[model samples]
Target chain A: MPLSEFDIIARYFAQATPGRDDVVLGIGDDAAVIDPPAGQQLAVVIDTLVAGVHFPLETDPYDIGWKALAVNLSDLAAMGAEPAWLTLALTLEQSDEQWLAGFSRGLSELAGQYGLQLVGGDTTRGSLTVTVQVAGYLPPGQALTRQGAAPGEEIWVSGTLGDAALGLRLVQGGLEAGDSAAEQLCGRLNRPQPRLSLGIALRGMASSCIDISDGLLADLGHVCAAADCGAALQYADLPLSSAARDLIAADSGLGDLPLIGGDDYELCFTAPADRHTDIQVLAGQLDCPLTRIGRIEVEPGIRCLEQDGSPRSVTGQGYRHFNESS
Target chain B: MPLSEFDIIARYFAQATPGRDDVVLGIGDDAAVIDPPAGQQLAVVIDTLVAGVHFPLETDPYDIGWKALAVNLSDLAAMGAEPAWLTLALTLEQSDEQWLAGFSRGLSELAGQYGLQLVGGDTTRGSLTVTVQVAGYLPPGQALTRQGAAPGEEIWVSGTLGDAALGLRLVQGGLEAGDSAAEQLCGRLNRPQPRLSLGIALRGMASSCIDISDGLLADLGHVCAAADCGAALQYADLPLSSAARDLIAADSGLGDLPLIGGDDYELCFTAPADRHTDIQVLAGQLDCPLTRIGRIEVEPGIRCLEQDGSPRSVTGQGYRHFNESS
Candidate 1:
């Protein structure tokens, strides 16, 4: 009477994608068939999340499934593409009915919101691993790449940073939050919301963009290397949620926690000086906070400074798969 | 002085895929960009080949690379699609230089020949497993599905079946063959020749098709079940290579080896009975053999017969993943 693969797939993982007519074949075939809009390019990305690597071993399975697709969708979001179809390569450790049901349920909810279809892939037996290959469509010559930032452009980011990392520390018992706020931050760690709408809003306006996966600084370095520009960040301008600020203010040992501790999944994009007001308007319309925390410069290196004018050399603290053992 | 991820990727993988206008972006970026042809539906398929599970543990990695992509290509072929692009997820046990060189060389050769651009995928540390996802396109309303075969249709198989299985057994020391014949069969097992040309030829002519990954009997059974019809296969009509015949004739216990042994990658399709001659002629044009091996029936199951008038219910011996290690 426990959940079979069929039961798990049907009950919680069934069709929940949004409306679209371009799909010729959806979740049931060898692959999802889509009619790419004429003159548009298809952007594809694959991301794999392994147990004990991307997430904690004791984390919720639903969060694991949700985030696996969510991160790939985040990649599509970074490129200003409309996610269409996804293929999941899942290697399960054991077939647990309860785990699969919750996992599929979480995945179904997200796929429904984005109108993305589950395409064709394989289920294999192995140590737990989820690899998702997502395809999205970007209008001709319109994809947001990381190499287009100009020296004079303003640097911007969506939503608050460091909450997820703060959540992580809280979950690990290294940091403390009040009972009310602790639950919220821990949920942030388990379910990092991908800013899909923000990506779409910045398509043409932003000169360059990348999601904050490997910390704000490390990921910003990618934009710098690709764009051949330098950056000057105003630490005081970085918008921190009251929850993150309260947690960080309480813990003095976590240096540059917001700058280096990754898993924010927010958009860090750059745009021309004149487009700031337009971005502000878009932010207001979308109901997501847009923070202008830095500016592009011709000096050809990244610079972070406090309001007191002291240089803050932020090092990368993002999870490196092999170097650090959990 | 050894191969880093980027070096191995650049030397072996990058620029190895064929350059086509449809491929807007190849390797060396965050992801790949492609444009599926206008008015066509993209067909996608991903297949994984684990060392010691799919092939002999000591089988040349070069052929492993080739067969990995080839099997995925076969799935596209079954759908009457034109090969377009592929992504590879390579999970290596270690970064062995010699193994990577051979794998890249073989994979590059196959990718170039089939007009597929190596798109985007993942690389990770794990037990040796290679997953290749292939994308193909079929003109709207023209893709041959497994559900279209009629009861009165003629079942045809392109090229030969069971050569690879025979080749594998010979290499595994289970069966003996002459040195030259063994070499040939071994090559078949290693580098499967996907019937792409035959599949394209049957796009409009064939009603239903499936690539023979599982043995002909099992795969044809899949087609029959999907099409909601039965089939009566003529045992003597099976197109067996000289190598398969010699091996089977020599072996004493490997009962009806061709019927159950799989991984042929040959195209088994059904066409209207009246177009049999045209189908054969088309096969000749492509230099690929097309043999009529069976006829569809109104009943809902497969029946294989001997050269004598007696009906024979053969034991199902097609490959199953669990049968090997699980």
Candidate 2:
């Protein structure tokens, strides 16, 4: 017999994470009641992932669950918020017990790491889709936003760029797979980490911050647009993994991926030049790579310069779902 | 020349509701930040509506927007929470300007009534789907849950039952349409008013409550299961609109609808027998019809008795998304 909706929830989703004191009521209720701390404000974000749109349909369910939650956490992380509670609205084509089990495991493992409780959500039968909403806590008047960058501020990014986009190519058979580097890139595509710790550490140090879900140039374009500033990027300063460098070296056309590819899930932030030393020390303590990629400029457009200071024209404006060609 | 993702958000969704002081940041950011009051606990709920499954594919976009938010608010209402914030995840096959305009209007009008500010969400390209998550405030320790009903408590339901189910039939062409009664039923199906005021008023009085989304018998079954009790309903006492009554009189086979039909979005609750007079007064104040349909029992199952005291067997258990047949 096929599992009913209630059975699926009870067996796979009801106990996804341990109970938290702030969660007065968790799963198995019409709505979850939560007690937010008195002094802290809440940061809420929602994101949807559709099969064959956000990811390939053949992607593992485990990776789907992990990536779904990770993307929303990335948004909260950009705001320097502490992870709190989550609600999931899952629409599946059918109730496959194995798929549900894998997805549950992936979601619960990450949720347990952050002390996040799965509060309440709806599970329905439809085309495969996952929508996750996360609410986190932020100190009053201290939220990091995109509108705080200033001219001459140093732009910094954590982790390598373009790996996830490269990973997607490998997953889609556009690139040759089976190599160790290929596997690593594919892993990056499947499970991009949310930079929560770095976001929290840079609370007072960084002037503005955003997660690089829509490529370096495009997401930074958003920050620049919001701050009413521009940015100048040193091409050599952009961080790249050895695999990405190798691929780009083999075919220079692939060099644009580091600038135009989406789904990196790394932080792109700007801060005063004098804070550079402090950011380096913080990066060492956190054991996360931090690269100084560019600087905010008074001009009102993004520029990428070569080592000789010549400009390179970039064409793509990152990924948009409803563009004319798409 | 099609609208891009960002354009769609900025034009149709960014300013769907008036700005509120609690919303520190609204749209056009990585996430939204909100400030909750000191003395209140937050109640959170999420629901999803998929085209061709939850509603007909040709249904009006305005009703789709209204209902997506309404169902989630209904859950909060069931918990006696005051509506506060909402996040929507909309998945569309294409970006249609006319559809977007209608959806925004319907969403904004309802949100204005409740002072609900749209915080943040994602707009993605995929099959047509709408997922809404709502956060509301509840006085500390004052939320109504399904576990509070005791034996011998009277079960009462607000407004008419089975109207939305009949409305669905009319919309689906299962029943003849175009009459005033059919139009009224269709309207009931599309726009379910979440009983927020009534729910708030019942906070101190009702022992247990649930919104009737999945039929009267099935929802009462949930309350009974949670409270570890049973219910006995009087068949003659079930409230019905004139249209529904006339339809049932014409065909006895449709009699089970009021008992087992779903999507009523009305509150079914249990309270102490002593509070009957107070509840009647509340009904008069709210101008919403209230019906005393049943009583909680010491037994472990639900029963429906005719006026002469004969029991009627109920075989349906309301709607479940992933049942064997579904």
Per-candidate RMSD vs. true structure? 2.9, 1.1
Instruction: Determine the TM-score of chain B of model 1.
Output: 0.95
Candidate 2 lDDT over A1-326, as tens digits, reads 77887898899989988789999999887899999999999999999999999999999999999999999999988999999999999999988999999999989888888999999889998999999999999999889999899999999999999999999988888886449889889888998889999989989999999999989999999999999989999988899999998988887878889998999999999999999999999999999999999999999999999899999877676887989495
lDDT of predicted model 2: 0.91
Per prediction, the TM-score for chain B is 0.95, 0.98
Cα miss at B229, model 2 (Å)?
Answer: 0.9
Where does model 2 sit among the CAPRI classes?
high
Q: Where's the lowest-lDDT run of ten residues in candidate 2 chain B?
A: B169-178
Tens digit of per-residue lDDT, candidate 1, span B1-326: 44544556767787777788888777755557887777777888777776666777898888988899998888878888888888887776567879988888788888889888887776666667787888888887777667788988999988877788888777788777888888887887888888787777788899888888879887788788877889998888998888777766767455466678788888889999999889978977998888999899989888888889678767656775433332
lDDT of 2 at B81: 98
- Estimate, for each residue in B1-326, the C-alpha lDDT of model 2 and write its tens digit: 88998999899988789888888899888999999988899999999999998888998889988888899888999999999999999999999999999888888888888999999889999999999999999999999998898999999999999888888888877776449889888888888899999999999999999999999998999999998999999999999998898887887777888999888999999999999999999999999899999899999999999999999877676888888484
**Model 1 chain B weakest lDDT span, ten residues long:** B317-326
Clashes of 1: 1
**What is candidate 1's DockQ?**
0.38
